[model samples]
Every structure is written in C-alpha cells, then in structure tokens.
Target chain A: MLRAAGDWTTASIGDAERAIANVVRQARGVKQLNIAGLGQLDTNGAMLLLETAELAGEGQAVALTGVRDEHRRLLEVIAAASVRHTDAPDDGNPVLRVLAEVGETALKLAREGVELLSFSGAATMAIVGLALRPWRIRWRGLVTQLQATGLNALPIVGLLNFLIGVVLAYQSANQLSKFGAELLTVDSVGVGVLRELGVLITAIIVAGRSGSAFTAQIGSMRVNQEIDAMQTIGLDPIEVLCAPRIMALMITLPLLVFFADVMAILGGAVASMFALDITLTQFAKQLQAAVSINHFWVGIVKAPVMAVMIATIGCFHGLKVSSNAASVGQRTTQSVVQSVFFVIAVDAIFSIFFLIIDV
Target chain B: MTSDIPASTHPLAIHVRGLRTQFGSHVVHDDLELAVRRGEVLGIVGGSGTGKSVLLRTIIGLNRPAAGEIEVLGHLTGTGGAAAAKAIRRRWGVLFQDGALFSSLTVAENVEAPLREHSNLSPRLRREVAELKVALVGLPPDANDKYPAELSGGMRKRAGIARALALDPDILFLDEPTAGLDPIGASNFDLLIADLQKSLGLTVVMITHDLDSLYAICDRVAVLIDKKTRIDTIPELMKINHPWIQEYFGGPRGRAAIASAERAGAAV
Candidate 1:
C-alpha cells in the first residue's frame, strides 16, 4: 500500500517526489495504493500520484483510495491528457546518413560561394560607379568607420607584434649562438618580421576585431528590421552600409600594416640588444644588409587583398543573417572564423606567387 | 509550514500601502494603496507608460518600491532576504508580455524548467507532468518539441501560460496576456483563464490593455491615474468621474467589448 502525507504543493514537492518514488519502487508486486493520509494535495501532486498509478503496469488493477472529489477531477484531467508518443527515429543506414549530411553541407557551401562571388561583383560595380560620380559617396560615414576600424586598432596590434618580435629574437639568439653566429639573429628577425609575421598578424587582428564588429552591427540591424526600413525609403543598404565600411578597411589596412612592420622590427631590435648584446647600430646595419626593400613591399602589397577578403566576408555574413536574435550571434562568429581562414589562405597563395616570380 | 493555514483566513492575497516608485526625477507612483482579495481576478488598466506593469513587477519582487510596504500571500516583498523571497516566489508564477520562454529550450523543456529546479521527480514523471501542463494550456502535443521561435504568436502565449502553471501556484501574474491575439483568440484565452481560475481557485493579477479581457473575466478593475491606483468593481469603476477612465470605458473599443460580453452572457 502507498501512503502520502504532508503538504504536496510546490514547496514540498521534493519530499513528495521522494515519497512517491519510494512507494512506486516498492509497489511493483503490490496492487492497492492507499492515500487516506495524504494532506493538502494540489494539481501538481495529483498529477504525480496519477502518473505513479499509470506506471504500475498493465492489468495490475491499481486502486486509489481516500481521494477527495477535487483531487479526483485533477486526476481525471491529467489522465485524459497523458497520451505519450516518441519522436520519429531515423531509419537510414549510418554510412548513408553521414554521406547525406556531407553532401548537404557541400551544396550549402557551393551556394554561399556563388553568392559571395556575386556580392564581390556588385561591390566592384558600386566602387567603379562611385569613382565615376565621386560626389555621391558618404565621406563622413567613411571617415568615421576609418577611425573606428583603423585608428582604434593601433595599440593592440603594436603590442601584440612587439611581443611576437621579442619571442622570435630570443629564440633565434639561443639557436644561432650555438653556431657562434649570434649576430645573425638580427637577419632572421628582420626577414621574418618584415616578410610574413607583420602583415599576417595585422590582418588576423583586423579580421577578428573590425570584421566581427561589422557583422554584429549589420546583423543586429537586420534582426531589428532596420534594413527593411532603409529599403522602404529607397536606400540601397549595400551602397550605404557596405561601401563605406569596405572603403574604410581598404584605405586603413595598408597604413596599419606599415605601422605594424615598424613596430615589429623595433621590438626585434630591442630584444637583440638584450639577448645577443648587439647594439642598435649593429642591428640596424644587419637589417639593412639582410632584408631588402622588396621584402617590405611584398608584405605591404598583400595588405589591400587581405583587406578586401575580410571586409567582403564580414559584410556578406552580416547581410546573410536571418531575422532571429540567435542568428546574429551565429553570423558574427562565422564572420570571424571565415575571414581569418580566408586571409591566411590568400596569404599562402600570394607567397607561392611571389616565389614563382622570384620577388 | 505556512501551507497548513487555510487560504480563506487571509483574504488579501496582495496588499500595498503608501507605495512610492520613481526612476530618477520621474515619479511613476506615489501614495498608492491597493489590495487584491483571495480567489479573485483583478485586471489592472491604464494609459501607456502609466506603470501598470511596474506595479505587477514590484509585487512579484522583480522591482523594488522606493517607499512602501507590499505584501503578497502575507509575506513582505522587497524587504525579505533571499530565502524569504524565494519562499514567496514559489507561491506565485508570472507570465511576461512576450511569453519570454527561453528561446533555446523546446516547449516541453521550457515547462519542465521550474519542476526540475524545485523538485526531485524522476525523469519520466517530470516528462509526464510537463506534457500534462502542455495539454492543459491547449497546445498540440507536437508543439512539445518545437522551439519558441517556431510557434505562432498565440501558441507561444499558451506555452507561456503552461510554464507559468507548471507549479500550481496560488497566484498567477500575467502581463498583457491578450495584447497581440485576435478577438476570437483573445476571448478564448479569457475563457481559459476563467476556467483555470475556477478549477484551481487561483488569485490572478493581470495587467492588460485589452478591454475584452477586462470585461470578460475580471472581478475588479484597478485604474492607474494621477500617479496612484483606484480599485473598484467594473460597474463602480465606470461610475467614477475620472476622464481617462471615462475615455477608456466609453471609448468605441470599450463599448464593443462590453456589447460582446453581454452577448456572450445572453447566449450562455
């Protein structure tokens, strides 16, 4: 026999549940459920009791005693509504399921790739059209975005690359000193910082900071239906929103890369002085002899291309955001990941091209 | 321990006296006095930005009154420590204006949240109880697995109510329950509240601008004006000489709502 006592309201639900569990577990072979001692039962408690009785298995003839009329109504309501069904199970083979999922993702990627190409074409047309009619460009918005994306990112990029330069010089000093060629640490630091690490780190930082900002701003606007409001008033969102940001990034990134290159080299020089006991004069002379002007130009020339990739991917994901709050966060994360990956991949291609042409 | 006291001895489910609420230099309410009796549905009405929703929030301990004594279910709100506040909170359930179900969890999981947090029921029993609450609010069984974003506006409202009723609290607070529903859906919601109130003997406090809901189910109407509340039965409220109340109750929408309620009564 099952007996429940005390208040069965929400306040006492924990104790009530424990009691019900104890009774149900011990009532496997028992038939009659007694509740004459039950006190202060409400709908939640009644539902729990009714559920326990239903779980007593088929043809067990479970009988509930001492139930008042009010509790009985609630039990009937719960019983009438307790029809349970499970969600449909997937019937396909596991191998086929994996293949189907891979195919679906590839198709989605292909579709998005085409969309990105079309957006690039449209953006190029807008840039050309604006060049022909320079009076129509929003110079104020362009300046503001330039300041936000470029000027604000200076300190962080400088500090990070400075630390990278220090670590590189320190490690090179350790290895080169074994060969009694500690002065060669300046050559390694200059070439590495000038040709690759400087521009690569700057691009990655911009993609994370400004690119994610672009996606989050536009994605939130899309979620709030402000994009539709803009279109209603005959404003092309791409021209008004995307163009200024892209122009800002294209103008500011090369300058930031130049700044990053200077900072990284200076950091390498400072580290060389401390680790290899090389004077600043000697470090400068070695950098001038070992790293050619071609190395710096190669890194700077890749800046505009990386800028285009980050800006376009950021704006593309922003415009692609669905009208849900969750989609804004998802699109922002995707923008950062995609832009960083593309920037690195394009940098590798540039490296190969420069190698082939013997730059 | 307080559950053993019969509900009737405490006629006032909610009591607020000398209440004052302010935000910066703006005062939303001052010297406000109101009381909600046991087992009654009280509809709070006012013009936009008149602090009807603020009053509900203050009573439920979501907002603190600047100066006042507010008691719900005989427990003081806002002055209570964490344990006392939690005890009071478990005695009532609140439904926000937009359903406010966690967007990530499915409908069934949303209903199961309070039960999981406050009880030790086995997984199977919790699932059963969640489904029962889902059905009690008149949602389809298939809606159990759907997200809040996937449901229609009316369905989301029902799911919100189901979550509110998950624990069978004595007091149910609803904010703009029928604001976005159509006339038919609004009346159906009113009927649902009336049915649940009768069956469960609930004390309901609703903030609503829907005249039909106020006319359909409210035992009394509280009008917020002049930075305070005026509580009375609907007929008595209509007899007051306040301009806002007159405009609200004598407005075209108000007239239509009253006519519809009369028609529904005559048919019944």
Candidate 2:
C-alpha cells in the first residue's frame, strides 16, 4: 500500500514529485494507492499521482482506496486524458531523413522559381499596359512610391558608396605605391567605381532595403485580408500595388546608380588626395582620361533590369503569403534573399555580355 | 512557496480599489472598486469604450492604473518586487482575445513553455503534462504537433486554454474568449470553461459580450457602467434600473440567452 498525503497542487508538485519518485521506485509490487490522506488535489497533482500509480504497478492499473467523490472525478478525467497518444518519437535513420529534406527543399525551390517567373510575366504585362494607357496610370501611387523607395534611400546609398570608394582607393594606392605607380590608383578607382562597383553595390542595398519592404508591405496586406478586399472591390492588386512599385523602382534605380557613381568617384578622389599626394585637379584629370562615358553607361544599363528583378521578386513573394503572420515574415526574408541572388546573377550575365560585345 | 505566504487562506481572489485609468485627458475608468470571491466565475460586461478590457488589463498589470490599489490572489500586483510579481503571475493564467500562442512554437511546445521556464520536471514528464493538458482541453491528439496557424479559430482558443491551464493555475483570466466562434462553438466553449472551472476549482474572471456565456457559466456578473463596476447575479442585475443594464439583460439577445439558460437548467 502506498499512502499519498500532501497538497498536490502546482505549488507543491515539485517537492511532491521528488517524494513520489522515491516511493514509486520502492513500490515495485504495489497495486493500491490510498489517497484518503491526500489534502488538496488538482489536475497537475492528479496527473502526477496517476503516473506514480502506473509506474508503481509496472504498466498495470492500480486501484485507489478511500478516494473522495471529487478526487475520484478528477482522477478519472486525468486518467482518461493521460491515455492520449501524442506524436511518435522519431527513430528513422538520420541519413535518409536528411536526404529527404534536401530533395524536398530542391523541389520547393523549383516550384517557387516557376511561380515567380509567371508572376514577373504578369507584372510586366500590367506595367506595359499601364505605360501604353498613361491616363489610366495611378500617378498618386507612383509619386508616393517614388518618394518612399527613391528619395528616402538616397542618403544611405550615397554614404555607403562614398565609403566603398574611399576603401577601394586606399587599397589600390597600397598596391600601386609598391611600384611607384600610385598615379594609376586614380585610373583603377574611377574605372572600378563607374563600371562595376557603383551599380552592383547600389542594387544590393536596394534589394535589401526596398525589396524586403515591398514584400513585408504586401505580405501584411495579404495577412490582413486587404488583398482579398481589393479584389472583391474590382481592383487589380497587380495594377494598384505591384505596378506603381515596379515602375517607381525602374525609374529611380538608374538615377540612383548615377548618383552612386558620382558619390563613389568623389570619394575615390578624396582618398587619392590624402593617400597618393595627388591634388583634386590632378585626380579629376586622370579620372577623365582613364574612365570613359561608356563605363558609366555600362553600369547604368544594369540598373533598370536589376530593379525589375528585385521589385518583381519582392511583390511576388508578398502575393504568395499565406494567411498567417509567420508567413509574412518568411516570405519577406525569401524575397530579400532571392532578389539579391538574382541581382548578382544578372550582373554576371551583363558582365559577360559586355565582355563578348567589347562595349 | 514563500514561507510567509498563507496559501489559499484569503477569501477574495482579486481586490481593486480606487482604480483610475486615463489616456491623456480621456478617463476610461475612475475610482473603480471590485472584489472577486475565491472559486467563482465572474463575467465583466460593458458597452464599447466602457473600459471592460482596460479594467482587466489594469488588474493583470498589463496597463498600470494611474491611481489604484490592485491585489490579485493576495499579492499587490504592479507594486510588488519582481520575484513577488512573478510568483503572483505564476498563480494565475491569462487568455487574450486571440490565443496569442507563440507563432513559432507548435501547440505542444506552446503548452510546455511555462513548464520549461518555471519547473524542474524532466523533459518527458513535461511533454506528458502538456499533452495531458491538451487532451484535458478537448483538443485532438494530433493537434499537439500542429502550429497555431493550422488550427481553426475554436481549436486555437482551446489550445490557448490548454496553455493557460499549463500550471494548473488558481485563477484563470479570459478576455473575449468566444468572440469569433460560431454559436454552437461558443456554447461548447462555455461548457468547457464551466467544466474546467469545476474540476480544477479555478477562480475565473472573464470579459465577454456573450450573454449566453454570462448566463450559463458566470456565477456573478460585474457590469462596467459610468467607469465603475456594479456587481450582482444575472437575475438580480436584470432587475436593476440602469438603462444600459436594462437594455443589456432585458434586450432581445439578452432575453434569448436567459431563455436558453432556463431551458438548459430545466433539462438538467
């Protein structure tokens, strides 16, 4: 016989559990729990006692002696509840499970790729249709988005490019100074900033900043049922939401890239003045001689393409958000990552094309 | 657990005196006083902007009243030390309007969270207790593995109740527990609450607009009027002369709820 006596409420369950553990270990052949001395009983205590009885009886049902009416009811409820089956513990081979996960992830990526392509096509068609019918375009949304995605982004973009320009010039000067060819630092900084780094860095920053913002904005709207409301009201979410953002990004990206080029070159000039004993006038002259307008144009040409990829991917993921708050966060993160990957891939393709064409 | 504490010796579960709550110059509640007895379900009802939720929030220490003395389970809430407040919080559980389950954790893990934080129970035992609580709340066995997003509204609320009962709390606070559920689901929820309260011997404070729930489960109704509380039984409250109180319990929906409650009583 096991006599359980204590306030078995949550407050004292910790101590009671310790004491019960000792009793259950010793009562190997016990078949009865006498709870007549049990003071206060709750679900937690009832569960603990039920477990104790099971462990003591070694998987057999242990009968209780002197159970009160209320304790009887409580124990019956807990006993029935304790019999529920939860998820089975995983005993599968780790290797096979990992392989399965890898394959599932790959399939998910491929499906997402196809969906994103279709969404891009739909958005492109909408933008083209709106461009042709200029009067039907939402000028207010365009202006608002342009200010939000462009004007607000200028300072961060400018500051980062300028800092990158300084770092590049300093690194180049360090290399060129070994051979007393420090004058060529101007050539390297001007050409690198105008041809590759300027637009690449700008596109990456915009992808992280505006791209994630687009996804989060649209994703939350999806979560809130605002997208469904818009559709029910006969408004095309693509036209009203996606088009303005894509159009504004397309218009601002090239201008931002141009701004980035100017800021980075200015930064390179300042670094050269400090590191290479070169004056601003000489730096300007060398930059003019080394970097041509086509290098600047090469960088500018990738801007609108990157903008389209980034904005479309962001909006696509946003539209794909399921009706939950977590989905909004997950989609937003995916949008930023995909947009950055595509920006670098498209930039590589542009570089190869430019190399083959010798432009 | 404290040596100085007298466990369950107090007659009142919650005591509030001179509670004055304001947002800027707009007063939501002023000089509000209330006392809740132990082991009783009290329903708080009010019209829009009458501070039903505000009073609950203030009492729970979510929103501190501008001036008030709020005591819950014999502990002075919001004015106590961190350890004291935590002890008080452990003795009670709150269910928000929505389940407010952590979106990242599954239902089983959501139920285990408090145990993981507060108890020294083994991992297996904690899991068992969480599953038992889930079962106790009438959620399916499979729901233990599912996320809150995957569950229906009613199921999510059930999961919320399971989490609230995770510690076998002395008091359960529910805010708008059946607001969005269908009529049948709401009645079932009322029954579930009534059953849990009886079995667990919990003191329940519920803020609800459901007259049926008030009529069916609440032992006493606390009506929020003129920024103060008028506490009475439903039948006694119905006989009061306040216009809002009259329109509330004597209204069509209120009458229907009372009629249904009477029928249920008759059947029982």
Candidate 3:
C-alpha cells in the first residue's frame, strides 16, 4: 500500500518528486495506492503519481483508491495529454521560409501603396470641401497642431541645420584653399545649404519627430475606440483629425524651411570667418551675391510636398493600427521610416526635374 | 471580531486585520477584517468605486494600504524585504482585469515567463509544461504561438489564466475574470475555476460582479459595503437584510443565476 500525503504543488515538487521516487521504488510489489491522505495536489503532482503507477510494473495495474472526483479528472487530463505527442511543426527549408517572407512583405507593401493613394484622395477632397465652407474648418485644432508640429520642432531643426552648415563650409574650405579659390567656398555653402541640405534635413527631422507623434497619438485614440466614437457621432474623422494636422504641416513646413535656410547660412558664415580667416562682413556679402533667390525657392517648393507626404503616411499608419498596444509602437516606427524614405525619394525626383529644366 | 483566528490546524491562506486604504481622504476600506481559508473559492463583490479591485491589489502588494496588517500564506506581504517579497510572490499568481498579457509574447511564452524566472528547467521542458498548461486551460494547441492581440476576449482570459498557473501557485487571484465574456463562456470559466480549485486544492480570491460565478463556484462570498467586508456563504448571505445585500442577492439577475445553478444541480 502507498499513501501520498502533504502538499504536492510545483512549489514543493523537488521534495515531492524525491519522496514519490522513493515510494515508487518501495511500492514495486504493492498493488494499491491511496490518495485519501493527499492534502493538496496539482497537475505536476498528479503527473508524478501517474508515472509512479506506470513504473510499478508493466502488467500489474495499480488501482488508485480513495481518489476524489476532481483529482481523478485532473489525472485523466494529464494522462491524455501525455499520450498525445503534439509538437509544433518545424520551419521547413530555411531558403523557402526566407523566400516566403520576402513575398509576403512585397504583397504587404503593394497593399499599403494602394491604401495610401486612397487616403490621399480622401484628404484632398476634405481640403477642397473645407475650402468651400471656410467656417467648417476647425481653427482651434489647426492652431493646436501648428504649435505641436511647427513651433515645438523649431529648436531641434535649427540646431541640426546649423551643425550641417558649419561642417559643409569647413569641408569645402579645405579643397577650395588648395586652388587659392577659398572664396568659392561661399558659392558651395550657399547652393548646398539653400537648395538641398537645409530643407532635406528639416524634412527628415520633422518626419522623425512629428510623424511618429501622429501615429502614436492617433493609434492610441484608435485603441481606445475614440475614433469609432467620433464616427458614430457623425463627425468625419478625415476633416476633424487628418485635415487639421495636414493643413498645419503644409502651412508650417514651408516657414520652417525658410528659417532653416537662414540658420544654415548663418552657420556657414561663422565657419568661413573662423576657418578661412574671412571677415563676417565679407562672408555675408559673398553669400548674398552667390546664393540666388531661385535656390531658396527651389528648397521651399519641396517643403509642402514633403509635409503632405509625412503627414499622410503618419496618419495612414496610425489608422491601420489594430486594437493592440503593440501595434501602436510598430506603426509609429513604420510611420517615421516610410515618411523619411518617401521624402528623400521625392526630393531626388525634384532634383532631376530641376536639372533637366534648368531651374 | 478583529483578531479571531480559525481554530484549524491549517493556516488561513489570507488573513487581514484593521485594513485601512485611503486616497486623498476618500476612504475605500476601513477596519476591514477578512480571512480566506485554504482550499476555498472566495468571491469579492461590490458596486463600482467600492474598492473591490483595490482590496485585491492591496493584498497582492501592488497598492500599499494606509494602515493594516496583511498576511498571505503565512508571509507578511508588504512588510518584507525584496527577496522575501519575491519569495512570497512566487507562491501566488495574479490575473489582472482585461487579461493584461504581455502583448509582445505569444500565449506559450507568456505562460513560460514565471517558469523561466523561478526554475532551472531546460527550455524544452519549460515549453512542454507551458503547452500542458495551455491545454489544461482548454485553449487550442494552435493558440500557443498566437499573440494576445490575435485572440478573442475569452481566449485571452484563458491565456491569462494559463500564465497565472504557470508556476503552480497555491493562491490564484483573479480580477473580474468573466467581465466581458458571454453567459455560456462565463459559466464555463466558472466551471473551469471550480475544477482547477478542487484538483489543485487552490485558494482562489476573485473580485467579480458575476452573480452566476458567485452562485456556481464560490464557496464563500465577501461583500464590501459601507467601507468594510461581510463574509458569508451564499445561503447565509441571501438571508441578510441589509438593503444593498437584499437588492444584490434578491435582484432579477441574482435570482436568474440562482435558478440556473439549481438547474445545473449545484448546491447553492
């Protein structure tokens, strides 16, 4: 006869397993096991007892007596589960899995492209409708978004452009001085800063800062079902949520680009004064003579386009977020990455067009 | 009434005395004394803002009481050092409202978290035990690899239970386990808890407003009213004449739950 006693939970399984092993070894000739004295039993404990019974002998079926109904059911569950060996299927063929993943990603990207187009169309219609009914515009929401996406982004954008301008002027001075044409450094700085680096860097920074913020904010609202509540209350989410943000970005991004151009030129002037021994007045005069307003216009022209792309991508990914906390983080990252990528791609296309048409 | 201990050889799973919890002068529980015996299902019920969930959190050391003594499974819960508190925490598991699963992990990995934290089991065996727990909770085998977001509300709840039972805890604390479940699903969950409790000899402390669960599986019901607790069996509680208890136990939903339990041949 064998009696299982005391608690048999996982917390005490180490001692319980040892005790059960000793009991099973001694119970080789025993035919009955009594669980009547078993104070507490869990799945692990029950599994141990079942194994002991099996180890008692092959053909000698040990009868478990004094078994409570609940314990009996538990033992039965463990017994059934043990017999059915259901292992998760292995990932077959590493090459095939990689190919499959690539294919799936491509399909996902194609679907996203279509969705983005439709979203852009809807946003355009909303802007036109709001233009027709000027009073329908949410001025308060527009001002709030302006402060968040525009004013709050000023310091980082200004500082980053300033650093870029200083680096460019220093690097160009080295090569220009070799030919005794150090004054040509002003042309390089003016053209590079105003026509390319200033606006491009500003756009990338805004994409990372404001784009991810949009996704996180709207994704959280979607998670909490606030978006659904808005629709149910007969408010067009596009007009109320997307339009204000888009309009604010469109209006503020151009202004930000103009400010970035000024800061970068100021940085270049300071660098020229320090590195090339050029006076500040001479640097300013050369910069004003070398940089055409056409170059500044070219950079400012890309601002609204980059702004629209970033805002649309951010809000689109946000709306695509499923009702999971994890999805918000994932979508926010996607928003920033996609917005920056598209901004650079569009800027490249614009550069080619400008060169072809001799802007 | 304040210090009466049960005259049993086995210590109570939870013993509370002179519990006072307050938030900015909003008293939640005052002089709240309660005891939960070993191997019993205790259901805590109260209206909204009555501090039922707060009491559960307080006991689990997530929220500190303003003044009280809380002893859980013979360990002073909140008064201990970090290692001591961790040891006590390992002896119990808590299931939060809304399942509160780690959204990043699959169901199987979620169940394996405590095992990995506390035991030296190899990865294979830990995974095997996790699969066994998932099976025990009646989840489909395929759910092992699925994220919490991919599962329905009831399935998520079951996954949460599987994770809570990962370390084979002696005490299981659940917060509104069946709040978003349908009637059949709720009753099934109740049945599962009852079955698990009986098999494991678990001490379950659940905060719920589900009358069906109270009628079906709870061995004792603790009602919080007027900032204190009143603990009694279902029948004993039904006889109490307090206005809140009267309306609660004798209400239409309560009566319907009782009738269903009777039909199912449960001794109410």
Q: Which model scores highest in lDDT?
A: 2
Error of 3 at A355 (Å): 1.0
Superior by lDDT: candidate 2 or candidate 3: 2
Candidate 2 per-residue C-alpha lDDT over B16-117 given as tens digits, one digit per residue, 9 for 90 to 100: 999999999999998999999999999999999999977877876666789989888787877556656656766777787667666546999878877765
lDDT score at residue A219, model 3, on the 0-100 scale? 86
Chain B TM-score in each of the candidates? 0.96, 0.97, 0.94
On lDDT, the stronger of 1 and 2 is 2
Looking at candidate 2, what is the lDDT of residue B265?
96
| Model 1 C-alpha lDDT per residue in residues A1-359, reported as the tens digit of each score | 66556666766786667767776776675566777677777777777776677665345767887877757777778778766757788667999999999999999999999999999988888877878888868786798899998999999999998988999899999999999999889888888887899999999999999999999888877775446433322246788778889999999999999999888888988999998889999999888888799899989999999999999999989999987999989999999999999999999999999999999
Off by over 4 Å in 1: A9-22, A25-32, A85-88, B1-268
Candidate 3 deviant stretches above 4 angstroms:
A1-85, A90-96, B1-268
Poorest lDDT segment (10 consecutive residues) of candidate 2 chain B = B1-10
Q: Write the per-residue lDDT of candidate 1 for residues B116-202, one digit (tens) a residue.
A: 655668989999999999999899999999998899888988998888887788899888999889978888999999999999999
Number of backbone collisions per candidate: 0, 0, 0
Candidate 2 residue-wise lDDT, A1-359, digit = tens? 88888688988998667877887898877889999998999999898888888789997778899898879888989888886557989869999999999999999999988988889889989989998999868787789889988999999999999999999999999999999999999989988988899999999999999999999988877775456434322246899789999999999999999999999988998998898889999998888887788988898999999999999998999999987999989998999998999999999999999999999
Model 1 chain B weakest lDDT span, ten residues long:
B1-10
lDDT of each candidate versus the true structure? 0.84, 0.88, 0.86
